[model samples]
Target: MEHIYLLALVGGGLIGLSATLLLYTLGRIAGICGITFSLFMPQITDKKWRITFILGLVSGAFLIHLLTPIAIPAAPTDNIYLLIIAGLLVGFGTQLGNGCTSGHGICGIARKSPRSIIATITFMAIGFITVFVLRHIWGVI
Candidate 1:
């Protein structure tokens, strides 16, 4: 348990450090959703950088999986339709909020952006309510 906590702290610190470094170096916020969404924007002048950045994310994940025999628990079983609906809801929420967890929760909160703070709080509240409704109130899952 202590090891897990230590690993989590290290991982979170690395994420924060990397995000800060990216922001400092690129003069762009380390909001992954924004970076990814920018790919479709007409004014995206640096496509190669975006593509390489995205590729690095994928490659990094693959490298971690290969280097560490991590235990990824099986996803909780749930109704397929409900799962799809939830996914769509989350997508809509991210769009409406102008960012997702990585954007608001990670980088935004770290920088103390008021807008991001509100969005993060809202996102977490919604998540908590949804889980409560599904598991306790409605017994959906």
Candidate 2:
């Protein structure tokens, strides 16, 4: 339990640190969705940094899995159609929100942006409702 808390703190600190560093160095927000979407557009300048940033995220996940992995159960569903729908929904929501949780919750909120605060709150509220409906109402946990 104590170890979990320690890891949480360390992880949060790293997130904040990374956000700060990106703002300082690149004059931009460390939003994963924005960075990732940039890769698809040919006209966008400075693609290298965005690619490196995304790669770093993937590398960090791999490192964590190698070092001290939390036990995540296998996903409950194997349906390809469901997965595709979920992915499309997520992509649409990201666009609608103008950013994902990392952008709004971590970088945006830290910088004290009102829009980020509202977006993060909305994300949390919607997430809670979705989980409640799926687990309790729909019995689909």
lDDT by residue for model 1 (1-141), tens = 698899899888878887888888887667777778778888988877778878988887788778898665578667799879877987777777889888899888888999999998988898899889889999987
Judging by lDDT against the true structure, name the best candidate: 2
Winning model by TM-score: 2
Q: Which ranges in model 2 have alpha carbons more than 4 Å from their true place? A: 68-76
lDDT, candidate 1, at 94: 76
lDDT values for all models: 0.82, 0.86
> How many clashes in each structure?
0, 0
In order of appearance, the predictions have TM-scores of 0.86, 0.87
Give the per-residue lDDT digits (tens) of candidate 2, residues 4-116.
79988998899888988999998989988888887888899899999899889989877877787566447768878867877898788887788998899888888799999
How big is the positional error of residue 42 in model 2, measured in Å on the Cα after superposition?
3.0
